[model samples]
Target: MKRIRFVLITLSMLLLAGCGLQNTPEFQPTLQDQISLYCLDHEGNLEMREESGRLQGYCVFTDGSECAEADFFNGVCKAGEIFGEASKRGEIGVLSADEAVEVEVNSGSVDADSGSDEIVLE
Candidate 1:
């Protein structure tokens, strides 16, 4: 019947549209955006500097007696100890290696404070 054919065509169109949506790429936020949101949520702040083509930085949570610091290079912290505070805070959970790379990339954006030769996270 004509009605049956129309209904089948409509359902087919709907199914094709749904399949197209599933294949569409979703937007992914940059690592810096995530860090900024986390800092805002946790009352934390970050300071960083680039020296001799290396990035050094730290993050502190004002409301908690916890902090993290590292000298990042080649997608990993030089000393492998940057996430101590992150682990203690426990909200962000464990960071993967890729996230660590993101952190290093984010640090590349900071300008060194004037006349400050060294930044101590402690």
Candidate 2:
């Protein structure tokens, strides 16, 4: 009887621990709901834009050839080849609404250079 009780108690503890883990907030990468800001390259060129209430952001070369496209939300860029290249070249910036001033992309906070092809916004 004592052994059964011990096993049951152990199982209960494990279940509780699992429940706790499930309740704990996980690191989920979610896009911003609104376009509060847009990201640009170093040359002050627009890297991301919203079209028809959709997020449409991409990277283009001087020759006008699109290299990569990434979703931009709340100043965050996710998944694009050209975006990663631009990021590596230190040519990424974020601009807030009603402000022409460009802000540097935070390397620690931004997931812009992620090579994943997953389109988060649209």
- Mind giving the per-residue lDDT tens digits that candidate 1 earns over 27-73? 89876656545544545566666756976445554533323332232
TM-score of each predicted structure versus truth: 0.27, 0.25
Give each model's clash number. 0, 0
Q: Estimate the TM-score for candidate 2.
A: 0.25
lDDT of 1: 0.49
In candidate 1, which residue ranges exceed 4 Å CA deviation?
1-28, 63-66, 69-122
Q: Which ten residues in a row have the lowest lDDT in candidate 1?
A: 71-80
lDDT at 89 for candidate 2? 36
Q: Judging by TM-score against the true structure, name the best candidate.
A: 1
Instruction: Tell me the spans in candidate 2 whose CA falls farther than 4 Å from its real position.
Output: 23-35, 39-122
Q: What does candidate 2's lDDT look like per residue over 1-122, in tens digits?
A: 99999999999999999887656686664443122223243222345667659866554434443422333332244322233344533466532233454346444333468964333432
